[model samples]
Target: MPSLQALKRSARYELIRAGLEGTALALNFGLPLTNPQRGVIFALHHVDPESPANWAPNAWLSITPTFLEQAIEVCKEEGLIPIALEDLPERLADPQDTRRYVCFTLDDGYRDNARFAAPVFQRHAVPYTIFITSGFVERTRSIWWKTAQDLVMRTDDVDLSTFGIDTRVNIEQRAERVALFDRLANAVNDAENEDTAIARLDSLAAAHGIDPLAITEHLTMNARELAELAADPLAHFGAHTLTHANLTKVDDKRLETEMVQSAARVGGYVGAKPTTFAYPYGYASAVGAREIAAARQAGFVAAVTTRPGLLSETSGKAATALPRVSLNGFYQRKRYVRALLSGLPFRLRQT
Candidate 1:
């Protein structure tokens, strides 16, 4: 028998699909505007289906293989040009050129990236950047979203009161619960210790009477796969962090180690110093002025955060602390493409 939570999730999926379909229809028939002067930088994570199913929900943020191809076509038809991260500093220096642009970036360096997404980029001649977690690539036990999923699905009847997580959701109210799960995922990502976060998941499972390790078996990507992907021309590597820690929670020295070590390790594998960095859980609270400075000191040419905005001529030359619009699962609607390029809104939201 399906659990109430499972049944609710099924219904929520239906609602989400309906909403997306409606949004797509509106984009195709209702909102058609031109912004010849603007471009967007898109963010992606988890490239393959082999990711721990529980830990990495495909619906959380992923493009179907078909959507990936279609998005490329749409960009070309709409007169958008896709550029590499390395070229962004140059292009943003001149956003008035009136050539539509899109810079594609993948974060977290999952092994499935090489297996799934790299070929798509290569065939399309698209240039991309892959930001990696050095600790995981270098053989350290780490917590990733997939591992978190393992904690969720494997554990049943778990309690999370100690972690301040609320798991009381009936099937009819699951949309809200799943949304809360998303926030909890972010909270876990922001936690200082990977172990603590894992434990919290375990506790959540214990509260629900499920096994904690259900998904850990499928969460990791292999080192050989990462090395192979690093050698590709269409792809470049960047630093996410040593252990994927939220830089703001740690002290300066630890932050430095995470940043510098991650860059060094990834650079060694990719045969080039990682020139780009993306703050783990990149946001105002997860990252700050100090963290940006630290990335620069670590020798990254530019850094990106989860802030929603496009780069402009006056945005400054500190590529190490560059801002980016997060292109997650919810941003699939084509209207978002326009929203991302519209600099006026971000600048307005800034104040």
Candidate 2:
């Protein structure tokens, strides 16, 4: 594990490079970098410090307020314009002009996005899209990460009933608990029923003498709050399904309902027909070429995944099924961003 100081330093460098300053001469360094593609969509999750360990494989890649500011400056300086997913069809028709543009999108509809991220975009006059999952919107529950963090921090013990792995945990057990957390979190993440997962969390908290409901309340956003954000021109809504289930594991009918219904419900509340879809736990194993094509079949213009890479004109129209680098907590190094954009640091997992 990287020390907090090491992580912060890494983050500072990424901010410098990807944020406006590094972009100025970044391409000249002969890394496999490309100018902002016709529609390079940025994917982000939570911005809340309270929710540190995100579901993304490496949460450190997430941008801080400082990094976000730099990113905004870089976008404007590089002449990378923003567009909504609804505008993609028309923009794609005029490829040359669109290739240099960028779009900002957030997944999971966390409150900090509206509370923190939106203002940054607004201050820069950039438009952004928020892909919301209805379960969290109506329920106002703590998201998975915050729930897990609360379990780890608030209690001196934890029990993993769902996985049949029960144990007591505390600060001294921080390293061990994080390892255990990852193990159980994966099972919880992979489970079809969030309730089953929650029950396990409840059992775990109970074992540790923590209140599960209190923990749940701290993680999610409510419908009313999402509605207010939808009112903003810069804020557009998209589908993240009713429940955050892995779409690939479900049958086609259920998948469509999850994909289409979530879009419709969020549309009704947000007052706009969403045209984009972001696959939950989007990756090669969780979703691939077929699932992405299905999202398009469901009337979406684009679908996004967690696969790390760039989207270029040469990348294909299925660029709708584009791979995005997760802006998470784990990615702190400026060199990492340089490597990612230059196409040198990370590679897609070959399944």
Best by TM-score: 2
Q: Mind giving the per-residue lDDT tens digits that candidate 2 earns over 165-279?
A: 6544344455544554565566576678755775676566556666654543454566777778877888888888887777777788988898888999888878887888889
**Over the stretch 75-155, how does candidate 1's per-residue lDDT look in tens digits?**
666667888787776666664554556778887766556777788888899888888887666556445455444444443
What's the lDDT for candidate 1?
0.65
Off by over 4 Å in 2: 1-39, 48-62, 93-98, 140-142, 161-163, 167-171, 189-198, 206-216, 314-316, 332-351
Candidate 1 wrongly placed segments (more than 4 Å): 1-38, 48-58, 94-100, 159-195, 198-217, 316-318, 331-351
The local distance difference test score of model 2 is 0.65
By summed lDDT, the worst window of 10 consecutive residues in model 2 runs over 342-351
TM-scores for all candidates: the values are 0.74, 0.79
